[model samples]
Structure formats: structure tokens, C-alpha cells
Target: MSWRTPADALRNELIELFLNHPTESLSGETISEHFHISRTAIWKHLEHLESLGFVFDAAPRRGYRLLSTPDILFEPLLQPHLSTHSLGRSVLYRPVIDSTNRWAMELAEHGAPHGTVASAKEQSAGKGRRGRMWASPEGGLWMTLVLTKPIPLSRAGELTLLAGVAAAQSLRTLTGLDIRIKWPNDLLLNGRKLCGILAEIRAEAETVHTAVLGIGLNLTVAREDVPALLQETMISLSPSTSSPWTKARVAGAILSALEPLYDSLCQDAAGFSGVRSEWIALCAHMQRTITVRLGEQVVTGTCVDIDERGTLTIEVEGKRVQVPSGEIVRTEVW
Candidate 1:
């Protein structure tokens, strides 16, 4: 359940107008007239935009000048820039929620289409792989993309790798961090978690149903705010960058950058040429000696390679041992 303020709509309309007329300053009075609203209504809209971190200049004669837009999220503000026709045809944004993935799953059960997206500012009960809690704070990007592709059930596992590549590309673009992807969707930066992806599905009989791609990227929790051990355990966009990263910029970069990769994966299955190759390129410890931890059982082997199914292959003794997404995790982190 999400609600959008009237101010949100007005703000988006103004953003569309401004982006359309890039060089010209959009006057507040002109905006109101264009939207068939009042001057005071325009003021309220501008105030709301400011609250969302957009910067604008206002003068008595000129009305309002769109100077620079901040990186805070306003779904309507991001709607136009979503870029994908089928993917983001539907999107829901919530300022606070328990889990965007859970919400998206519920929507899927009710027959949401492919590429329907749900995002939240806070997740009180965010869950990572193996039921570990993901402490989702307000200033981070918490999103779930509900996907229903035509691929066979066996091919579904590729989404995890797809997500990792997308996230890595976005981080590289935004903060210029030399972020890497560990096997099975753990995003690593200097060997610390910068982002994580949890892929889930709901099926009815043998027919494939839905995939909830839950993604969480740590953005702005300073060290002092985090619990002592977690402060050392987790890393955010704040640590690697010289300055702070706003939610909007990070979110936009992720969607804009990743949408194409996702498009490619959906279009070309055998030719996962870029996605597979780039994922391997971003992995810090690819083909290196490392131990794969699968529950109580631990397997020590040389990291040989990753297969097309996104399985990590370990060279054990004389044979190659393959660990699937749901089974193994990297135990060692630097």
C-alpha cells in the first residue's frame, strides 16, 4: 500500500517540463498555468521538491529557477527516466516498509506483470540470504524487481548473476569504486559488503511463476550509527567515496545502468556474452584458492571458474566441485 502526495505529481510534472526544456528556467507561474493550478499550489510543489533534496532558486519576477536537483527519491521524479518500456511500466515507492521484496511478492500473487518494481526507504524486517537480517536504513536503496520471463525454470538462476553485474556497474559509475562481485550475488568492495541480492520465487505446479529480486545497497549509515561489530562488518557507499551519495543518484544510476544488461539477458540467453564475462571480470577472487562454506560442511579447493548457470566451480583434489547459488557462500572476507 503506497500513497503519493498531490505535491509529488506536481513536482514530477515540473521536472518533466524542466528536463524537456533543459536550457530554460521554468517559471513557477508558468508551471502553475501549464498544470492548470494556482501559484500557491506551485509554491507547495516546489517546497515538496526541496524537501526531497532538489535545489531551485526563486525570485519575485522569475518565479522559480531549477538550479540543481538533489539525489533524493521521488518516484514520480524517476518515472520518466526509468527507460524500460515493459520493465518499469508499474512502480511503487514507499517511504517506509518492512521489505520491498515481500511487498512485490504479494503483488505478484495478485498477478503483477513482469518488471513491476517496488522500492522502500526503510525495511524493518529485511532478510538476506539464509535468513540473516539486512538492517535496511532510510537513506539506502531497497528495491525488488518482480520478473516473469519466458525462460525455462532451469534458466531462472541467471538472474542472480544479472543482478550482481548490474549493481557492480552502477557502483562503478556512481562512486567510481572498484567494486567487485563475489559468486552468487554478494557485492564486495575491498572485500566488504557494499550490496547484496536475494533471489526468490513463488511457483504454482511445474509452471514457473515469479522471481523477486531483492537488492539492498548500503548508502549512508555512518560508522558510529552502526553497531560496533557491524560497523566493521559492513561497508556503505559512504566509505569508498570522498563525499556522501544521495539515494536518488544511486538508485537512478542502478536502474539506468542495469536495465540494459537485464534487457540483454532476457533477449539473448545463449549469448550472455557480456553479463557472464563482466561478472567474472568484477569478481575479485575468481579462479583463486578459496574455501566454499555450505552450512556445516566446508570444502577447500582452488576456485576454478563459474559456469553459465552462475555456479561457482572449485577444483577439489582432482575434480571440479560445483556449488549452486542456494548452497555455498564465501566464508573468508578481507
Candidate 2:
């Protein structure tokens, strides 16, 4: 459960009205008359918006003026920009949570609908691939999408790749930065990590009951916000020269790109092949000599291709080695 109240709906409408007239001041009398509510109710809603980081300027005669809006991923701010059919239709936002993925998995088990999204401003126990800990803090996008439909266990890897493709494309379009996907589940920017994706499955026997896809991006993260150990290896998405990209806009873009690809993969088998090609195109280490660490075992090889099943095929020694799961610990070019 979300903490949404009946008042949020009216507040969302009020937000829209202010957004439409961004420069003009909205008089309390006009707002109350438009919403058919009392002046005190409008003031309360405005106060709530202020608490959520919306700054307002009020005058005796001129009324309230929208000074600035925060970069937070509030659902109402994102809803108007979203163009997806199902993905992110219902978003559960938390100021702080253990993990969006953890909460989303619990919701999926309890029959949460497909395309339900969970997000948080900060995550205490955020996850990464292969049980690694992700650094999730304020000024970042920590989110999860729950898929309620059952899927075959074999296609789990492809789902992660699909998410990578969606994120890479969206970031490139939104920021015009050269965002690349490293094999497995990392997004790189300027040879440094900018985002990570982790896909978890809840299943009984061999059938996957639910697939939870979590993404964490370093958008608007300051140097002090990142852990000291990862400062050198990670990069943040800074605002472009043209305009600042808000967390809500970035979230909406990624979700919009993901929903159709997800539907295509679940509905059509051939869609995985297309996703594989896109992943390869956006891949950061294709055809490069790299060393992968599989626990105690390590293998060095040239990245060849990603198969339809999302296996990273490497040319090691004289033959092709299929790596189903491993960490690319070292890259030659990056």
C-alpha cells in the first residue's frame, strides 16, 4: 500500500492547472471556484504541494505564482508525460524504502497487476546483479516494475537485456549522451557506470510466477552522495546545456520505451532476437578482449555476440565459449 488519500486527486488537478498556466498567478478565489471547493481546502492542498518541494509565491492581490518545481519523481508530475499503455499505469512512491524491488515482489505475489511500478527516493538495501549491493540514495531514480504474468524460466536473461536496451535508448534520447550497455546489466557513460539493472523472478517449480525488473540510475547525484569506494568507477547524469532533465521525465521516458518491448517479448517469441540485436548495438564491450570472473574461476575472451537467450558468447582460445552468467571484471577498452 500506497499512502494516497482522496485529496491527492484534487491536488493533481490543481497541479495541472498551475502547469498549464506556468507564468500566470492563480488567484485563490479562481482556484476555489474552479474546483468547487472552499478557500481553506485549496490552501491546504497548496501547502501539501509545498511540502513535496513545490515552491510558490503568494501576494495579497496577485495570488499564488509557481516559482519552481522539484526534481522528485512524484506520480502526478510524471503521469501527464507518460505515453505507455500499461507500464507505470499505477506507481507506488515511497520517500524511503528498503528496496523497490523487494516491495514490488511482495506486491506481485499478492496479485499486483502487471505494469505496476514501485519507486523510492532512497533505498536502504538496494540490490544489484549477483547479490551485489547497489548505492541508492537521494537524487537518484530507484524503481521497479512488476510483471504478474507467468513466463518461462529460460527467458529471464532476455528480460534483463530488454530493460537494458530500453534504458540505453531512452537516456541517449533524453540526455544526448553516449549511454552504452555493458554485458549482463550495467549501463555505462563515458566509460563509467551510470546505471544498473537487476531482474529477479518469483517462481514455483520451473515456471516463473512474476518477474521484477529494478533499475537504479545516477541522475542528479552529487559527488558527496556516492560512496567513496565507487566514486572513481561511477558517473552521474548531469543536466544538459539545453535543459535540466528531471527524475520524473527520465522515469517516464524509460517506462514508455520498456512497455512495448516487454509486451512484444511476452507475446512474440521472435521479439527476443530483435532485442538481442538492439542490445548488441548499444553494447559497450562488443568484440573486445575482456576478463570475466565467475567466482573462483576467471576467463579471458573477446566478446563475440549475445545470443537470443541472452547468453554472452565469447571467443576464448580457439573456440566459442557461452557464458550464461559471470561478472565482467576487467575490460580492455573501457
- Let me know the TM-score candidate 1 reaches against the reference structure: 0.78
Q: Estimate each model's TM-score.
A: 0.78, 0.86
C-alpha RMSD for every candidate? 3.9, 2.9
Q: How many angstroms is residue 91 displaced in model 2 relative to the true structure, after the best TM-score fit?
A: 2.1
> Which candidate number maximizes TM-score?
2
Write down the lDDT that model 1 would get: 0.72
lDDT (C-alpha, whole model) for all candidates? 0.72, 0.84
Error of 2 at 107 (Å): 3.8
lDDT of 2 by residue, 1-334 (tens): 5334467557767877888899999899999899999999899989988987899999998899888877776666788768998787766667789998999888776666788788888999999877878989897899999987666776767888888999999999987888999988899998999999999987788677788999999887776777899989988897523567788889999999988778777764655687777888898899999999878999999999888888888999989998988899999877
Residue 43 alpha-carbon offset, candidate 2, angstroms: 4.6
**Best-matching candidate per lDDT:** 2
